[model samples]
Target chain A: MANKIFLVIQREYLARVKKRSFLLATLITPLIFPTILGLFLWVGMSDTVGENRKVIEVVDENNSFFLESNELYSFSYSELGQEDAKLLVQEGLRFGFLYIPKLDIQNPKGIVFYSEETPPISMITNLEASLQSKMESLRLQASGIDPLLLSAFKTNVDIQSIIVSEAGGERISNSVVNYAIGFLAGILIYTFIFVYGNQVMQGVIEEKSSRIIEILVSSLKPFQLMMGKIIGIGAVGLTQFLIWILLIGLVSSLVMGYFGMKMPQQQMLEMSAQQGLFPADGNPEIVEILQMIQGLDFVQITLTFLIYFVGGYLLYGAFFAAIGAAVDSPSDAQQFMFPVTIPLLVAYMGLFIFVLDDPNSNVSFWLSIIPFTSPVAMMGRVSFGVPWHHLALSISLLVAGFLSTAWLAGKIYRIGILVHGSKVNYKVLWKWLKQN
Target chain B: MEILSIRSLNKSYGSHVALKDFDLSVSKGKIFGLLGPNGAGKTTLIRIVNQIIDKDSGEIYINGQALKMDHVRNIGYLPEERGLYKGMKVKEQLLYFAQIKGLRKQDAKQKITNWLEKLNLSQWKDKKIQDLSKGMAQKVQFIATVIHRPDLLILDEPFSGFDPVNAEIIKNEILELRNQGVTIVLSTHRMESVELLCDEIAMINRSKKILDGTIQTIKEEAKTNVFRVKMIPDSMEYVPMGEELRRQDGMLEFKLELKDQKPNELLGMLMSKGEILGFEEIVPSIEEIFIQKINESHGE
Candidate 1:
């Protein structure tokens, strides 16, 4: 039986790996991320359309406000009436106009932006920030303080999060890095389960539809065949993922080197500093980001990811296989698929709502402990630092969940693989499950 | 020696019984015919022997040993609804099956080459199964079933998709395998082939075996004590005391009631009046016996 299972796995793996479609998908999927990123960067860097700068006319009734202009837009202060500014905007003389009415210093109101198209949020935010700063300086002057001196005294505070371990010394923690790691790992497991679990189900449906399953079951038990398929396809997914990581890393680095571009880690550090997470004195050090990444317990998180990936796939893959066996065609599988997909969908939603928002929250804790949601939700929390005991409990429950689902699926698979030419429903499946 | 034996095996699916107290045995080197109409328990019995489905109750023995997973290694099954991996190359598919049946890789490769050559399929070795014609694919399915040289071969409707020439080839191979001491359980609706190949037969209907015995014995049991005689024209003055059923091609076919009289007594009376050109008792064909038995059971 063991040898037979090995043969089955070998056949499944080899058959898929040798297909042109598999090769194309595996090779192209990883490149998709870098490709989209490159496209966005190219579009941003290249300004082919030589259009006039967006002009905005500012009408300050009190004549106490001034706004600056950037490359994409030009602001012109005017003594023109509000009605005249609106008419100019209507005639396409300006992109829009900002009207500032005389306001109480403490409670300013009636500041409105009018545009032919809805202005971008960033534009509105920039305008609002400029106005608020000007108003603050004016208020400082009214209190008989030097506005320049007040600006000179302003200093940005940067908080460094550090974790002191019993054996290892203090290590800096970056919430941004932790969130990115958790989000990526959680999504990776979710994608793997969806992709390879479908492969297992499709393989079963193909064998059943082709009528090869009867011959297969003759020599090997149904459970062995099902497990062989699940494990085999899982290995294929792992192989694809590993290859994608290696090839994407190689190709992106080569391309970036050719373009004289900094690595993604350096770029992410710059982005973090630009987001005001670091002091604005100079460029943020790359070593700090690297240290924060190293401070994360990646070994633990990666190991847990692997465990949950396999456990989740086996649990869901069993249900997928059973659904595949129970239905006669791909079209017939949809009705059964909804219920099976519900748990996965819930886990995904819960990961975003509870785990990513606050990993230590009660909702996140419960979702991580539950076997169905834990594969995604737990990984989402792992990078945020989960309790050791909770992780162990989740892993144990997931294993038990996989085993029970496998047994149940084996029952349905044993009977359903042989059944044909009938509309199998939940009632029929229930009867099949009830049988020995 | 019985290579495969089943005793009082029973199986049911929900309220529908597929096999009930079914007993069968295929002796070594004999072709055992599992005859039945469509929807009879013949497939169910074969599936049990192949261990494809578990029997609800009963015992299955292979070579006098209780059946186990290892027993599957000795049995080859060609199912009624047969197919190969359509997208897989013929050689690779056959090798995969051979390996699954427990052959080592090198052994499977060698055997696959041999089977491909023997079946005149070497030219199509690299072709996907879907590329082959129906008859060619059926031949490949047969090779996959037998590539491991199993001791017991169970073929359900083995010739369903084959043309006559291909069917004949497979029929000859089955006989050759039987001659080499392989026990065969053949379940098919083609009774003519059963008459040609089967040594013993069992007919199943409605999940039960209604008739079973050696082919000759079953035929004998179904006989009506009828005889056909051909005599020289106009040589007899008085006819034998029997109902003259028909006269065709210079043969007088008659039905006899030998309640107390011996067959030789009637033969003596016929010989005195005419030259006995041909004389032989008539026995029913398997097809006739099958229908008659089924009708009798249905009547009861």
Candidate 2:
């Protein structure tokens, strides 16, 4: 039986990979995502060039330092008459004009901006941030406190999490690994359910609508045909997935090398600084990330993700194949799809709220051990440094889930593939599921 | 020896009986025709024999043994509806089906090559089924069905969608397979093909076999005993005496007055009145026989 199934798998995989659509999608889909991202970035960045006009003249009699940085729009200091600036605003020579009447010397508004069109949010934010920093310095000086002493009041609070295990030694910051595992698990499960479920539905619809099932059901069993199709299409999907992963890896490396060469080292450093993270110096978070990635515990997280990703995909794939056999049309399948997909959706919700909230919490432990949601939840927990015994239990549950779902799906698939013309309801599906 | 036999078969689509107490047998090497109108339970019976659909009650025997999984490998079925996957290339589709039918890759490839060459589909080997014309696709489907070389072949509406030339090509192929000692059961509405190819036949209607026999025997049995006679028109008055049907091409045709009529008396009367020019009997075509049988059966 295994050999026969493998033969079918080989045929399906080879046939689909050679298809124009599969080849196109494999080569094109990844490029499409990155291209779309780059396009949006380019559009946003282009709006900044050759388009700056708005300016506000600040007449600060108190010599208050204000508006810094020209990231959004360039600012130029001008000693001009208020009437002249007003005329310029009316004539559309300048976008707008602003004047600070006076600061209260105790409680000050400090700065104001004016614009015909509401000044871009980035520009307003930059101005407000610069003015606030300067005001804090002045306020410190007015209070007769040393500005350096005021800056020195910043307290460094750095936490180093540690995990000690009976089987394994000490670990640090397993939270990131656990969350990454969980996210990976959820993504794999979601992808399989959506992808294979529709394949089954489309396969059923194709056979039923074409009336080929009428003849096919005669020679072989309906169950046999359904199994063949699910296995066949699954093989096709797996082939495409493997190809896509390989292609994406290749493309990513090429892009990284090309962009790395093109970008100046200083600009790269500055960009990282702006995001509040920098490597080699200044920011400790980047150094921690690099360290964590190299740690022994990261190996465990990688291994767990690999196992759960495949297990979760196959588990959900079985249900998808079963649903496909049961429904007459894709639209009709949607009625049953909600209940079928609920577990995966609920798992995602569980990860977001309970598992990610407290990876070591009782809720995360239970959710991670449950077969239906374990693939994702367990991965999430792993990142948070879960115990070895829990990891074993989660893997076992995932395996059990795959086998049981495959059995159930095979049963339903056998009967449902031959049935057509009427809507398949819960009542009928239950009967099929129960039939010997 | 009989190649296939289906006895006391019964099937239903819900409350409506599609086949009831239907029995049929096809002998080895004979091209057997099954004639029936639409909704006459013909397709239902074929489906049961193929085991595509299960019968509510029946025993189907092949080669004097009970039907089993291996029986399918020995039987070739060309269904009424086209079953080729349109997305697959013609050669690839044939090979896939051939593989499913228990042919090895090498064997399937060899057979596919030969079949493609024979069918003049060599150039279209790599063409998708959807790209082929309906006739070409049908031919590809035929090749797939016959690729495994089953002893028993069942074809439903085998000539549907073919032009006269292609129909004749298929007809000859069907005959050639029969000549090679393959038993065939063909279900079709074209009575002309039945007349040309079928030596024996059984027709089903309304869940029952209404007629079954050799072509010669059934035609002989269904004869009306009508005759056409031509003389010097001395029979103008006697035509009424013999239930005169009509005159055609200067010949008088009539049905024998079966009440008290004597053939010798009628002949003597015709001889005495005028010289006998020509006389012959008229046999009904299969089309006429089918129509008459259906109408009479319904009326009864």
Identify the leading candidate in terms of DockQ.
Answer: 1
C-alpha lDDT of residue B279 in model 1: 75
- Cα error of candidate 2 at position A259, Å: 4.3
Chain B TM-score, structure 1: 0.93
Which runs of model 2 end up more than 4 angstroms from their true locations? A1-7, A32-154, A166-168, A174-181, A192-220, A258-283, A296-354, A360-382, A385-436, B223-241, B247-251, B257-300
Winning model by lDDT: 1
What TM-score does chain A of each model score against the native chain A? 0.90, 0.76
lDDT over C-alpha atoms for residue A110 of model 2:
42
lDDT of 2 by residue, B84-183 (tens): 6777788877877776677788999999999889989999999998899988877887888889888999999988877777788788888899999988
Q: At residue A271, what lDDT does model 2 achieve?
A: 50
Task: Tell how far residue B38 is off in model 1, in angstroms.
Answer: 2.1
lDDT per residue (tens digit) for residues A133-165 in model 1:
999999999999999899899999887888776
Every model: iRMSD: 0.8, 2.5
| Residue A156 lDDT (model 1) | 90
